[model samples]
Target chain A: MVNYIKLIQNENMKIYRRVGTWIMLSFIVLIPILVSLVVLLAGGDDDTTSWPLIMLESYFLFSLIIIFTVVVSSDTVAGEFSRGTIKLLLIRPWSRSAILLSKYIATMMFALFFTIVAFIVTMLINLALFGSTSDSNDLGGIVSTGIVGWGDVLQYYLYQFVTLIIIVTFGFMMSSAFRSSGLAIGLSIGFLFAGNIITGLFAMADKVWVKYVLFMHLDLTSYMDGGTGPIPSHPMTLGFSLGVLAAYFAIFNLISWTVFRKRDITA
Target chain B: MSQAPIVRLQDVTKVIGKRTIIDRVSFEVRPGEVFGFLGPNGSGKTTTIRMMVGLMGLTSGDIHIGGHSIRTDFPKAIVQVGAIVENPEMYKFLTGYQNLLHYARMNSSITKERIQEAIELVGLQDRIHDKVKKYSLGMRQRLGVAQAIMHRPKLLVLDEPTNGLDPAGIRELRDYLRLLARDEGTAVVVSSHMLSEMELMCDRVAILQKGQIIDVRSIRGESGVGSKPTLEEVQFDVDHPDAALGILEGQGSGRISDGLLTLSSDRAGIAAINRRLVEAGINIYGIRVKTKSLEDQFLEMTGSETIG
Candidate 1:
């Protein structure tokens, strides 16, 4: 267990050391700035605009997380196997399952970090540009520019962040299954590209279960605003999406460990 | 060598697709011994090493590392074994120290002092802080070795560890590995195409050919005696000398050639022939022992004409 933790710590450090982390985070921060500029130029009413909308806009770039997460997690095993470093690690005392799980958890942790930072940056910008006009204290209190209450904004970020976790995990699953990093990235991006199309097609087929698919429920912002399809309309059932995602996460990791543990390190 | 076999493989077979990459190979390395795995490229040397450490699954048979079965107790078995498959692969973006730290962290028992000690052991202390991408091939190999032994594993498996090294670097690595085996009792398994290098470093060797081991025996003093020629003298460029063929044919021991008949005879016959060739006015420009090389043995076993 201790070895697994150390392995995860090491895996996380690889991301922090790479230039990609800052590059991705910087792009994330830029999204809100751009959205605020557009809104300010158009002279939109502050009362109707919600910070959560900016987060929803960040979803377009959410595929970036998918792409990056796939690259990071796929390489965690396949890269080592190709480079011949798997020999070094596997000959160690640690179990194969532990090693692979550590890598998976580390990638998820990084995704969470990226999501939180983007959420905080967007929330701050939203408050800086727009003042609170809603009545309830939950929506009325503000730190600066009289924006929405910290509690409300925090809840909003949590909702988006949870959705991001599902996306990150799905990316991890794809990356773990594929050998080539580019293939992993492409397949993950391809899913995001084809997801709405597939979901729409499936939805139109009139299957009641289409709403329960994890991919269909990824857009939490739209779902949170009384928009309903797959995700439960009530905010209280937000844990359901998280639960389905956890099941996917469990299966993905289980397969990765089983395959990778017994995988021939041919390279 | 100690009584305990530090690493052992029992009838291990690794098959990829329809091809058997390593077929039913078995061997053992005792503590404080340098076991060389000599073979041509694609002859299953690397595959067998991969199986030894459980980096790959065995289609058949089993391997035990310091008494733990790789199939059933892989974690315990693997803990005592340190291996480098092809090139010693490192995270190019990380410094050598950081690379070691990462590997060290995975093991938990490997302390910072142990990482430093391993770095020093590989003679890379001065350059240990530089990023691995900036390292030379020799440095990378050394770093790979450093990572392997950081936890002081009982068995160290190195595959073609001297591939890109210069003569001096090869010598340095050889000495370090020998010292590690002697002083620390680490059993080392090294596979290489360089017959002379293996002869210089290993105590015993398993010569593999075409996914099968041709021979596994003690190499010490075995090459220079018993009319077994040196690997270096196996090749000879001869001018047309039909008379030399008559002399060899008369001797009744070897194939007659255009000029050179590679004779596998007793020590007395070899010495007598050398004297007879000189006395018979043959243009004996060169005469030397022709010990079978790892490549020659591989070709003979696999019946391959093209050398890998």
Candidate 2:
């Protein structure tokens, strides 16, 4: 059997060699720095000591990270088909499942790399601009006194990353199912943005099944700061939300593997 | 004679959405020979190539490479085969060296020195570090051949390898393929719609029409030990074409075109005809014999309408 690591290396080479990947990566590093610089130059009350509050605001850039990852992951398999390189790849000594797994792993690695870069860049810039202060209760609701630490923020980022994985897997699924990068990317980002608004309407229905929807559970960070369901009126546990997300993740992977493994590469 | 066949397709059939694309096609290719899949466009040449490399599934039959079934033993079977199904679409962002390294890393046995050797083999040593986007089509073709032969596969399959190339480039590739087969004992498979190219490059050719193998014939030089006399088409450029036709007394059906009498005759028959024409004072200016080409035979076999 060929080493699966080499296959991932091959994929990573193709990904990083493109200039577009670098462009997306640059935005991750620049957007947060620019946002913090605006605070430094324009606002006087939001001083350097309130970095955590600024980070709370910066966490919204996860949407940007998610979109960037969606673009990269969406092109994982479909790009090869559109470029006609899939034939060369499929004819190698590896099996179809192995190749698919390598692509999947490589795309997730790309997501993780972006998330980590965003985390580091955002943390550094916020630390450099607004020094560490625990005065903000964007999560202060967890405690009656509105006091929290870095641990809660770390939990928030970690949970957000878990959702990122599920979303990346969804994009990978679409790429395999549709075999078109544009369609896969379109559906993935659309699911993220529109699903948020649509789930808000569905979350208000008060039905027992309302909590089981995918987008309702995507904001895993909502579980932070003593949060229950996305609907604050309806109480639920993190375990239930995790279970629903896990089920969708498993289904998405199953579809991707089945479709790609059995596909006829006529292109 | 002791060498076994490197590739064998047994009763292969392919059906795509109620349409039979390939129908019970079977053939074998031995090592050290260039076997051709000659057919018109949309004639399953690309489909068969895709199936051979396990890119497409087998509907009712199996292809064996190096005695390993491609349907079941894909990794084992495909490890012995090297192919380019269509155009050599490469990652244009990467250098030629990186592209070769990408494939080299797939197989564990290929080393860095082997990659350097392949680069030199394709004469891309100077431009090996340049991105593929800067490469000409002919250069890409050489790179394609280099990748296929680098791993030293037992079977090398190239589909429509001569799609766009100058005559000089085509001849160079033809000579190189022949040398690779002869020196390394690798069975080479080339698919082309042009009969003249296959006749010059292949040892044996399988003519396909509408997904069926209509004929499989040896296109190489026939051995002289056969019992049947070799026939040659001798053309006599004479002053009186009609008089030359009458001197023959209608022994052979001869065609007269542009003041030349052309007839199919053996060497001995040519001497007799020449003597008869000399006795008849037909004033023969030149007598030239030409070997028959497979173009006429291919046209007759496929009925000329299907050639693209």
Cα lDDT of model 2 by residue, A221-252, tens digit: 66776778677756788999899999999999
Model 2, chain B: what is the TM-score? 0.94
Model 2 regions more than 4 Å off: A45-53, A134-148, A232-234, B223-227, B230-233, B285-290, B305-308
Task: Name the top TM-score candidate.
Answer: 2
Q: lDDT per model, in order?
A: 0.72, 0.84
All DockQ scores: 0.66, 0.77
Query: Which of the numbered candidates is closest to the native, going by highest lDDT?
Result: 2
**Candidate 2 per-residue C-alpha lDDT over B1-308 given as tens digits, one digit per residue, 9 for 90 to 100:** 58899999998899999988999889999999899998878889988988999988889888999999999999999988888777888888899989999998898878899989988987889998999999998888888887887789999999998888889889998998999899999999999987899988999999988889999998765733554788778899999998788879776889887778989898789999999989888898999987667777777888866433
lDDT of 1 by residue, A62-165 (tens): 55665666667666756665566666666677777777778778887877777677666776776677654443322223212222456655565566566656
User: What does the i-RMS of model 1 come to?
Assistant: 1.5
Score residue B243 of candidate 2 by CA lDDT: 78
Runs off by more than 4 Å, candidate 1: A37-67, A134-152, A209-212, A225-227, A230-247, B17-19, B223-302, B305-308
Q: Which lDDT value does model 1 have at B103?
A: 82
User: Candidate 2, residue B164: CA error in Å?
Assistant: 1.5
